[model samples]
Target: MLFTTPTFAEEKAAEKTEQYDPKGPILEHIADSHYWHMFGEHSLPLPVILYTNKGIEVFSSHVFEHGKEEYQGNYKYALIKDKIKPVTEAGEIDTTVRVWDFSITRNVASMWMGMAILLIIFLSVKGKYKTRAGKAPKGLQSFMEPLVLFVRDEVAIPNIGHKYKKYMPLLLTMFFFILISNLLGLIPFFPGGFNLTGNIAVTIVLATITLITVNFSGNKNYWKHIFLPHIPVWLYPIMIPVEIIGIISKPFALMIRLFANITAGHIIVLSLISLIFIFNSLWMSPVSVLFVVFMDTIELLVAFLQAFIFTMLTALFIGMAVEEHHAEAH
Candidate 1:
């Protein structure tokens, strides 16, 4: 055992001094960045978009050289912990100027790839449907039909009721988009590494859409329930504020739920993988690999479950907002 320990360790015992920094790399992998990492020092640098009072500037993120040095264009900017900020010639960050970044980051690229995959699959499926109308689906069509039907019939119809058709498109889009993004994030390679849905911004946007849909589709009865709440006149002062808060809270809940769940899964898997390096033991690899595979399989199930819950909850909220007075009479 002693003979093999020194040769097989990930890091020599003499060099292994730290307690293993899991948060640093794990957060990097799961967070948005201007480049897609391939291996050590090898990455695909994306374009950086910035708007400053001076003017708009566009450049390749490679100028930052993976955050080693500042990128000086017509303006000077430094990649400070994956964030680009204007810097002075002395290599100091210039706080005097305000800059807005709308860069196409790794997460954004992953989202685009996920969207492309969706288009390819659905477009092909649509073509197949036209060619094989009313017949049993085969191949990819066979694979997708049940999933589509589940979202349409199981999610949309039951929750949104008769008006479900109008919202079917939105719900279906949410389900497949979240599903595809979640699945793509698990790949840990090109076109799939970044956590798009796991990003709070993306989840916030989705939650906002659901919020807008519910409010816009709300009927007279729905508004009455919020403002007037079928409560005593004396309770109006207390209940009105709660109702208003409830509207914002629902969507907020959606945002946090999806973000936390997905982010936690990613962190857990990364933590397990980090164990091997932290211990510098090849013996740990088998155990680490087994746990990772097990966690990944569980994450796959979570990917589907989360998508379903988000769509289902959205439909339920929309239904409540647009429901007729008679159906809600009881």
Candidate 2:
């Protein structure tokens, strides 16, 4: 009987070892974390800054040791599912203390890095323009000149007309920021793979900026079209409300489009990589690797396409707002 008991326990342990679940890990990878994760168990912990009812407290995220341990700040705190929350001495989550986390997370750090890269590239190009002064382009200027020209000639001039120059700065900023952020998310190494664009908060801010710009730039014709449409008097109630909704919906659509596309791309790539582990077969590596490469190539194109689409649409909207209404000659 004793021998049989030991055999049963061994079999159960083997079964547990063989079982694999990929959902938890996949979700964790896509979501934001306090520390910037590198390959395997290596990760750089970011600073943890919190504002609580007691006062402000600052520390390192590593103090929690990936949620395996709790740390004492101004109050007792624990990392609950990658979130810093106050906990009671009884080892339970404390609901009374409200915590405002102002920490620089993986996404925030990546955004700063992206902005720095953009500044360095553009500032160097600016200096070249001053020194060269109408000479043929070379090196970094050659690469960036075409993209800048495309946005101006193909995107801006076509939609926004002569007044396009007024909004060119905004258009350029949106296009390059989105393009760089999307490309950065596709990288699989440290300081590059953080999904800055995929984060919803970032998208919301971008959309809000577009919303403010569009409405503020609206001329008299644009205001008339919204509040006092050229429709029958009886349809005023119906069409007026519709026009108001349309104004808000445009930017809302932009927000969802960018957020969903970028996030889905990252999830698909991660899910593909998880397939080999799920199958528990060395043979699955070649098949999974091939699909991952193919998808990555498609994603590379999509990064540019999404940026172009966003800028093109914004220009179109701005043009609509600023267009002059021409009347028929008598």
Candidate 3:
């Protein structure tokens, strides 16, 4: 669920020996991409939606070979140093031209796919609730009912009080969206390798939404506490700024927490699996495989843990905002 950024140690090792740089491909797998990988050297193409001085230029990512090649559209573009850039007729990058990529990359596609899955699941469960009102929940209904109830009973009601109902839809949506996206990244194969939640862009959007929701839904008392604290008048100048920073800090923490947790899991799993190639020996396979199995089990737990932490923190923030009094929830 994270994009690869080369670490100082990795860069130093690369400089020492120009051989078997496993980190590059590992990072690419957990990164935003122009194609959906099916397997080795094969992938499904995504459309490049770019707007430039020439006009709206659209093309298939297949036209270029995994950033190793270039394509000519209204303007020529090459994937240079992991970025798509415009190039001159001589195949040199033309810094003068500006290219805006609004392309639907793999991560974007995975997000849409995850939402579609959620829609199907909830719609099916809703239909079941209507048809079998008093009966025991069956199949998919049985599976999802407990999770839905857990968030409401454990997260929302305990934190947000009676006003929990107003935010259930948003909370449920966030929880499942994150859970599913994290699970999708664990698949490591076709239709699932895209790292949606690990992407800072996606996490930032989620944090921003939570930020907006908290501030907007906050009551008069909330603002009063932030701007005019319980402290003395002389401390107002210092306290007010601190309180204000707290507001932004909550969401900032959320963004970093989710991104780091998810990305780290992917890196650890990939690094574990890479030991075999690094050794270049048949004997390393047994130890590497066993360790990888252990890591995968841990990652499975993390997939759910991250979702729970994110949702719980969100509920806690909302609780802090919408409470009318120091002791009261709502």
Candidate number with greatest TM-score = 1
For residue 275, model 3's alpha carbon misses the true position, in angstroms, by 0.9
Error of 3 at 177 (Å): 0.4
Measured over all alpha carbons after superposition, the RMSD of each candidate to the real structure, in angstroms, is 4.5, 6.7, 4.1
Which 10-residue window in model 2 sums to the lowest lDDT? 1-10
Count backbone overlaps in model 1: 0
lDDT string for model 3 (1-330, tens) is 222332323543564454456677677766787877765445788888999998898888878776768888878899765567999989999999999998888998989999999999999999999999999999999999999998999989998888999999989999999999998888866777767888899999999989998999899889988887677799988988988899999999999999988888888877876666577567998997798789878888998998988898899889878886855331
Candidates' lDDT values, in order? 0.84, 0.83, 0.83
Instruction: Indicate the TM-score of model 1.
Output: 0.93
TM-score for each prediction? 0.93, 0.91, 0.91
- Point out the higher-scoring one by lDDT: 1 or 3: 1
**lDDT by residue for model 2 (1-330), tens:** 011112223433454477655555556656688878765456788989899888778898999887879998888888887888899999899999899999888888888889999999999999999999999888999999999999999999998889999999999999999999999888877767677787888888988888898999999989998888877889999999999999999988888888888888878887787677667677998988899899899889989998998888888889888888795121
Which whole-number lDDT from 0 to 100 does residue 326 have in model 2? 91
Candidate 3 C-alpha error for residue 265, in Å: 0.5
| lDDT of prediction 3 | 0.83
